[model samples]
Target: MNKPQIRAHGLLDLLRLVAAWLFYSSTIFFHGSYLSPLLVHGYPEAGSLAIYGYMGVNLFFLISGFVIAWSAEGRNWTEFAAARFARLYPGFLVCMTASFVVQTLAANPTLPYDPSTWAANLFIVAPAFNRPFVDGVYWSIVLEIVFYGWVAIALFFGVFSRWKLQLGAAWLLMSVLNESVVHSTALQMVFITQYAPYFAGGIIAQHIVAKGSSTEALLLLAAAFLLSCKEVTAGADWMQAHFGFSPPLSSLLAANVIVYALFGGALLLRRRIAPTPLVLVLGGLTYPLYLLHQKIGTLWLNALSPAVGRWVALAIVLTALLSASFVISFFIEKPIRKPLISLLLPRLNMMASKLRLDRPA
Candidate 1:
């Protein structure tokens, strides 16, 4: 049996940290309404800047699709599912539990509600029923699960069995359909749009490997850097007012997909840089940080606005939450993830071996 190696782009992780920090700080600075004892007004430019930074989540999804598809290449569906679930669920469950407990304490107590809502959150399927969001971040996980199901179906049909063309087309079509017809930016983004391009990008990178071209990786890395800085709505004051392209799905997708592809390439190219253990640790902490940031921001913004000033308070809170998230990921989340995976993997491997062995021999 071949032992598996864990791979991720440390540089991308660094970029994610920057964006996460920027987004929270900028959002609080920009939105006075979010600040407790709120100022009635916010700087419009700051608001727009914060919104632009929110595109980072799309980049995250793309990177996820690329990495999972790249690493799980030629692996069985069970293995793929196990790997994704193990990486995503443990940290997510902990965060979800924390959010529910917090929300219950914070929210109005007069409303009648069922305990099953928390149960649904545990399964990560509460979004399907239009349940009230437990945390702002949980919605993204629901969408990610939908994306995973789509990947599983593609794998089931032996899509990756050939070269990556059919897989690319399938993802592309899903993206186009989501963007043009389904017309739900939130749904498309969460369910498929953002991930498709990243998966395709990774497939392209993998193809370059098969063809023995090193420049392919370099080009992708450069593209990622360029795309990350692309402000999709830059100088859109007149256009935002006159054109009325509310929500800006096409523009957002354009920026996000490019960024995702670029980062996907950078991650693939990291073999040359030889990332340090600390970089790897930061990369591992990203998911927990992603989950906790917004809720922490919301609470801090609400609690500290009058005392510390909105923007100043936001920066302080974001820093503390990020530090806490790192601790949680390293100590609590990582520990749980390793043991769960260890316990489950052997059973999965045995099952896979049996299925493959029973096929012929």
Candidate 2:
């Protein structure tokens, strides 16, 4: 077997940091009044503006598509599965437990903090068990896991490399059909129809990086971009139904354009970005920050805002969350990841061998 083909780039790390900040400062603080009324009582206009920040989630999916493609290279399905589990589960376990503890202490009505809920959350499919996530932001994590599962299946079938474009095209078509005409909850859950375009765009981005651009790739990318733009508004519609207000359609469209531009720029400039330690740290902290920010920060704001002021409370909460994320990433997650992978991989490989899934079909 050859070494991995894809190289790490700091630009992607920088983008992850940007996405985390956008979600924290804009979506959680301003537009998320529906989740926590206290956070947005006096910031209606800001909420409108900040609602555009939800595009950060779309950015995440695009990055995931690219990174996961990069990761899947030069590895079998077992290795891929083990690597993903080691990468995600440690941070998820630590952060989810922390959030549950904070929620329990705060006793926030909006956030649940029971032992059963916490136990269900350990699987990242708490909703399937009829429990809420410790943090609402975890909904995206579930989608990511589903995407990973599909990628692993593709790898096992030996189709991911041979039929990449064909699969992507089919996915894009199904996405359009499901979102526009089918509107089936089961399809949305299974295929992730609404967000398929962004993921396809990311995968196409990685293909360009690896093989250089071609007519088919560029055309597929363009289709993905257009579909992404169209689907992004669905989020706004959801906000309107729930929160009674959402960012203007023009603002949403503008933000979508900017996101794609930024992603494209990052890919173009990746060689120059130099994967520095600071950049790696920023990227590493993003996951923990995303997991820990919303519910814990809201609970902190509920306490601190009463004693201090809202702005001060916001500053304090952001600083604390950043600090906690750093600690979790460097101290807890890093140390545990290698050992966890080492322990899991042999077992995973053994199971794969028994099932004859260690080799691609």
Candidate 3:
């Protein structure tokens, strides 16, 4: 099979910016009101519009499915594991620590700042330690890690590439049953039942690109898209129950359609979008921006809004966070990732060899 022609383009970065700024920063952060009680909250019309921004998380999962599949191709489980660790851990450490310090200094009652919580968050599964995430957005990172673990396991068993379609179909079926019928929290959490469609769609997308589309692939993609539209509404239901507001069902479905369209457009236009330095920089900063944005930005808003007025305060917070993101991406992650990978990969490979799983790169 031909290697997937996945290329680095700025489109996904642009989507990340939308997810960070438009969805989380502009809409849900303010709309949820759980995190930022101090901000102005009388604008129902605006809140209605902003509620759809939550679908950015869906967009992220879709992107991850494609990117992770591409990254896993032809690599053994250890290499894939090492690469994913190198990619995720350094940035997470820097950003999580930054969040810890900021939340500590701000002393915000809404954000956790306890040392135990901070220590637990260091592992990125704070809930297992009975501590909350320093930032609520870290929940999605955990899901991404779970997906990566499944991929690594699949690679280990030598079934990932060969059985992707069958696996995706089975996963989709399980997602449907778990979400709509069984309603099992354990399944939802362990299998990511609610969001499986997006990931499966992304993997199918990668498969289509690499192996060329088949009738079966197209049908599965369509099924995944339709299921995604159905599943994203689960977020709206939660928001409605908690916040007493959500985008109209029509709006939610339409937004999912639009997000899927954007993904398709990005794929179709990947060749047209050059991997320019500015583009790379924009994409590079996305992870840090996502990591550092929510809790820290809200604290900034709560602190600065009373003084500078809300709009001005938001601008200031965004500007500072963007600058911080750039610094972390360029100065911290770029510098640390390679050396960390170099130091870590061989150890992992040695362990793999000991386990008799090592293969030539």
Candidate 4:
């Protein structure tokens, strides 16, 4: 129950959001030819440089673990679920719809809209439904949902608070074994074994804030870093194999290490972080910006590049995305959320309560 006192500037959250935009945006830079003029003839460097941005996603997972664990305190499963849904789904639905529209309308569309795929993306499980995401970012949102599911299950079992450290530690170790020994798709899906170390680091961060000495946090942080390093190495291998750029494995590891260190250091210095209403607005824009950026932003880049120069076109698109995200956050998403929460939450609470009651003594 010892969460931050709701200050003005979430230094860490802002940091995570920036990393998300930087890394993911860079990936788009390489994967597509939006900035072809800026790249060398073969675009070799772009691929390797963009690979490091993948760590930004891991940074997000770590932050989510910490924030979710901190937020879940002093709430029943109903409250937790409702809060998460209200915060995530309303904004997501708005952005996803916008993304669908923009991508569908683009002159040379990247993902041709299949009605089934768009519908599946509405549930954030396009692949499971044998369809594709309208936007690629939905994959990470799916992981966050899976993590939330496990956390909810833990809450229901009444083990989250009492056994968090042990649970997190075991999850980290399982990730190691899962990668090396089994390579089971089922295990990966169920536990999110690939990203568990980051989540585990988040949980351990909460423990550091709430209970443990800095030394303990440091030790657990070391374990998570070592495990996460393996994933980074694998990513390097994958990038080399598929993308044809062998970014020095050492550079990739160093970049990932810096990301982990920044996150851990933020936890240690979390007190200095101020939380303002602006934090919510910045946080709000991040998701919408992320959702709308890839397909549409690139379209904008392509469309405007002929008229304007490439870098100028890129700037225009970035500005447009930021403006669009702000509009979605304040005008559409925030307005829709209250009504949505009001309509669905009571029913959700009743169902969760019934489930809680039905549990055998």
Ranking by lDDT: 2, 3, 4, 1
lDDT of 3 by residue, 290-348 (tens): 88877787777777878887678867888898899999999988898778878888899
Worst 10 residues of 3 by lDDT: 1-10
Better of 1 and 2 by lDDT: 2
Q: Each model's TM-score, in the order given? A: 0.72, 0.94, 0.92, 0.88
Better of 3 and 4 by lDDT: 3
TM-score of 3: 0.92
lDDT of 3 at 281: 77
Error of 4 at 15 (Å): 4.0
Candidate 1 lDDT score relative to the true structure: 0.57
Instruction: Specify the poorest-scoring 10-residue window by lDDT in model 4.
Output: 34-43
lDDT of 1 by residue, 1-361 (tens): 2322334344455545544544445445433432323233343445434444545655555555545555556666665667677878878887777766665675723212356767777787775665655665676677677767766655655666463554555555665566447867776655556345444555555445444455644455334333323333332332466435334546655655555555545655656765677766666666777777655556665667678876777677667776877877888877776678777767866886777721210
Clashing pairs in 4: 7-275, 7-276, 8-275, 8-276, 9-274, 9-275, 9-276
Q: What is the C-alpha RMSD of each candidate to the true structure, in Å?
A: 5.9, 2.0, 2.6, 3.4
Model 2 agreement with the true structure over 253-336: per-residue lDDT tens digits: 888998898788878877777667887897888999989887787778778877887778878988999899999999998898
State the local distance difference test value for candidate 3.
0.80
Candidate 1: count the clashes.
Answer: 0
